[model samples]
Target: MSDDQAPSTENGGGGDVETVEKSEDHKKLVDFGLDTTVADELEKLFQAKLVTYDDLDPRALEAIRDFPIECAIAVLKQLLADSNLQHVNNKSAYICGVMKTYRQKQSLGEDKPAVTNGPDEKKLKEILDRTGYALEITTGQRKYGGPPPSWDGGPPGNGHECFVGRIPKTVYEDDLIPVFEKFGTIWDLRLMMNPMQGCNRGYAFVTFTTAEAAREAAKQLNNYEIKPNKKLQVNVSIANVRLFVGNIPKNKSREDILEEFKKLTEGLREVIVYAFPDDPKKKNRGFAFLEYDTHKSASGAKRKLASGRIRVWGSEIIVDWADPQDEPDEETMAKVKVLYVRNLRSNVTEEELKKIFEPFGEIERVKKVKDYGFVHYKERDSTLSALEAMNGYKLHEVEINVTLAKPANENKARERRMRRERDNNMNMGYDDYYSSYPPASFGPPPPMMRGRIARGGMRGRGGMMRPPAPMDYYDDYSGYGQGYGYDDYSSYGGCYEDFSAEYSPHPVTPQPPHRGRGRGGHHAPAPVAWTSNAAAAWPPWYAQRSGGYGTAWRGQSWHQ
Candidate 1:
């Protein structure tokens, strides 16, 4: 026979060995150097239906690989014996049972006989450690106390506690403890209770015996609904170092307050100063609240500043613990019924102001003084609405300040009135003046008449100089020579005859018309061609100038 088919005496047998053909899977077992006797036994077990090659746990095969073939067979036999079977029914179950026995023996520090050529105590320990089943083998019990280990990577309940928020108010300690105890041992559990209601305050603190427990509980119970509608909020509990600061300066702002406390110590988490409600001035009340990351910083600030005073805005402010239950009285709270308006223009009238505020609500009354006013509303809701709508509203081209009106003080009122009067005096000069009389009646007087002098030095009719004759010099209708001044009318023939006979009752003999010079050397009459049309159509002045009768006239000199 060829060497491949040769029967070996490795099993120490002289009888002719039957060469059994190995399947591909059986060849793999043989290639691992498993003894032929052991393989034969395993094949017999498979045939008997006690175990199958597929049923053998790979982990068991892996665990025994480093052992000698005889030793590996002995381990397998021990497993079967422990299970009270001639062969393992479930190979994987049998392997797990062997591991459990090993662990139990190791934990008890028992010296069990080694089934291998040498002791495998170290190997067994390695297997348990690699599988993470060795926690109990190391730390037998958790140590308590001291700020639990840095929880950075530590498991919950290792050294940390958790804060459970948004818990149902009806949940009590007994109900909460049992639910978390499943995660690990509970060190302590505190559910904040309301003093008056004697019920839970919707939050609690839970301390687990170990960080691992706390972390596990936090992971599973965070946002876990304990009630139908409420869910629990679990988080790592921070130290309680929040403080209440009282007697803050009314004028100090939130930033200013923060800065003040920051001087006491560093690490201030937050600062909140309560302010007067609806105050147009935006002033704060005399109290505040502060928070620190640790209790030490918070307590230090209280110790240093509580017994002493802090000066702000020229006033010494008191510092004390602020009670969370304390609140401003309802009477002191801002109520909308009256609005205080400031920065008003002097020219804004009550009627005009009324129109601006009227749209918000029914105005009970509006008391207006120079640059400020007060609008009283009939209803509180209307007042609030008006304040909201009209605050910072521009009126008369100016942004008026609107706020809830507080009680009037005598000194403040007097000061306001005085200030307004002074302002009015200062700005009155800039305002346009209004007159009581009609505008048209207050202009310059009418212009005077101007005239020129004549060539003979006689003033014109409209000039300041007076004329020689009166305006009525020719009042009579007698013929010219009968007297007033012109004596040339007799030459006009019958023209003067009608006038002379009517006024003198006798006819004067007709004579040629004559011309003569008067006082200024100006001729009294100038001869002209007379016609019957002229005599019939001429006026009294023209007839006199034509030498036909009557005294010289003194109106504007007429030119023919």
Candidate 2:
């Protein structure tokens, strides 16, 4: 049979042997040759079939932490393509291949199979079918934690990682790469240089072929040291580039692209290559965009000759070129009609009100009523949502009412008129009250007739002579002060009370008995008399003499 059809001794058998040996005698049936021979043999075996293993090199396997399991398997399949290399150990080959593939994928992008069930496709299919493999992706700065986008297939580009700082281009290409390359190949490097300020903004974008390489680079060189500088702050970065790559290869290959790129530039700092999903099989159509650190690199690439065709993996490859496009102009915020609300619940705050309407659209601003007024969203959508959601809503046991807010000018005018009317009414009512009332009036009566004057032509006998005792003696005497020695001024004959009137009457206020007095006889109050001009005739000591002695003096002075 031909060498191709011949069954070599390597397949668990010694074929065409002159004598048959016992099982123990041919314990090691396949004699492993030198490293090179073994490698070649392994390549031949792999061309026929692929091998798999669970255990792999820690560093190599970890290099593709974010890479899909199928990618790891594809890489291993490539490493074991030679029959002689089969004895290199499945685990070791897996680890080494994983690391290599990760680095390659970063700079070159993933590879797609040229034929159905080809070497790349076969390995990917095996890995996908293989069980018990998991992947994790992470990004961002070493100082602050980064955000890694989770993806289903092989790890996507590191473009989505959060970047907080920047570094110089020379530092990135010369000082940074040497340190980071130890972990894995750097597919791309981007250091945004602001036009206004030429210095680094303290951030960069890095891409790796395999998620494993990206992770190792991120871990090892994330805070790694660099000459003339303390350390290189490397991490997966967000896609700041205006352009991106799509349609990567399915085999998760990257080296072919890197090798092809080495011809163009002497020292390409980095290139970001990533896969855009077409299917679960990872069959890339073989085209991806390259991102450079500066616009100069992009420009240089644009100016460079194409040689009329692009080549990748020994096959003609298509290239998608990206030119920096101008950013779109910003639109101004629109002014909208707003309704002011009032009598909102006291607990309401601007943030709470904003959260209520955020689902509708972007809210430009929100103002909570400082005086328990309902909150206002800057946009109309939020206002509509609030009205729909909260109209007649019960808050603090009080139902709220929504209404259009009045203009400030109109409100101030209304308040002014109301205050003026209130003041005028108060003044008018006060004046009318005083006008409706009048002062009190009083007048004296006509003069009275004398006591003896006759009513008709003749006077009565008693009236003619002296008045006899009055019929109502007790009453007449009591009216004048009967208890004292009183003279009847009426009987004495006078129109008015005589100048020598006997007594003056006074009302007696009842007095309480003296509890401490033992068997005391109560004295009857004496009548008080008022003669004509008695008050004017009082002695000068009247302010001091005020008892029985004063009365006696008055009587004695009248006699004098």
Return the top candidate by TM-score: 1
lDDT at position 468, candidate 2: 18
The all-Cα superposition gives candidate 2 an RMSD in Å to the true structure of 51.5
Worst 10 residues of 2 by lDDT: 516-525
* Superposition TM-score, candidate 2 onto the true structure: 0.17
Q: Where does the lowest 10-residue lDDT sum fall in candidate 1?
A: 491-500
lDDT of 1 by residue, 1-560 (tens): 55433443323247665444344445555666666655644544454555567876666455545445554454454433332232224565554444444445546774242231111345434533443221110011111212323334322321246677786655654356557768975555555544223245567666675766776887798888888977887755433344645445567787887887788666576775434333435445454557664445666766666544645455544332321111112353254376766556667888988898998879977755334566878988888898889978877656666666543223323433343344335433211211211122211112222321232222211212212221121111111121101222211111111111112223323222211111111112211111111111111222222111223422223222
Candidate maximizing lDDT = 1
Off by over 4 Å in 2: 1-40, 43-159, 162-230, 235-560
- Model 1 RMSD to the real structure? 51.0
